[model samples]
Target: MSESTTPLVWLVIRKDDNGNRYRIGSYATKAEAQQIADRLDDRGPKQLYWVERAGQGGAQ
Candidate 1:
């Protein structure tokens, strides 16, 4: 196996009523992801979140 040191990106997902998560996109920074979520304010009722992998540099 190969070691991956590259930081994991921030993932934006939309959750459905059935508890299904749909991936939207991933960003290298939390700010970028939050910006997207903010822009989606007028879209509809959505379960939005910023997810980062372990060892990734981002706000906890």
Candidate 2:
């Protein structure tokens, strides 16, 4: 079987004290997402990640 070549993206995930997660935005690279997370560092606690999507236009 052949694998897909879908490009990966970096997502900025923000979780509040209530444990609710929000997908703020998607970036082309991990560094780009990290920059946004750094800026929001003072706002609250959050997590950064690089996720590989499924086939073209696959659902999250």
Candidate 3:
């Protein structure tokens, strides 16, 4: 598929106290992913949330 037609996914990542990181969710847009991250971040400081763009090959 062409670049323009290739599906892009924005990931909301969470890092825990033990330094373990994983994907919280995948969104079609960065704004959506950021929203989720921001909401989760406001819960507390124990865990950190951030948004990242998935690689073209679907890897983080």
Q: Each candidate: what lDDT? A: 0.61, 0.56, 0.79
TM value for model 2: 0.58
Error of 3 at 53 (Å): 0.6
Would you give me the overall lDDT of model 3? 0.79
Across 1-60, the per-residue lDDT of candidate 1 in tens digits comes to 233654546766656778666667776677777777677744767555455543454343
lDDT of 2 by residue, 1-60 (tens): 223443446676665666565667776667777777678875534443223322223233
Looking at model 3, the pairs that clash are none
Lowest lDDT block of 10, candidate 1: 51-60
Question: For model 2, what is the alpha-carbon lDDT of residue 18?
Answer: 68
Number of the top-ranking candidate, with TM-score as the measure: 3
Better of 1 and 2 by lDDT: 1
Model 3, 1-60: lDDT tens per residue? 776775658988887888788889888789988988899988866687888888643332
Ranking by TM-score: 3, 2, 1
Query: Weakest 10 consecutive residues, lDDT, candidate 3?
Result: 51-60
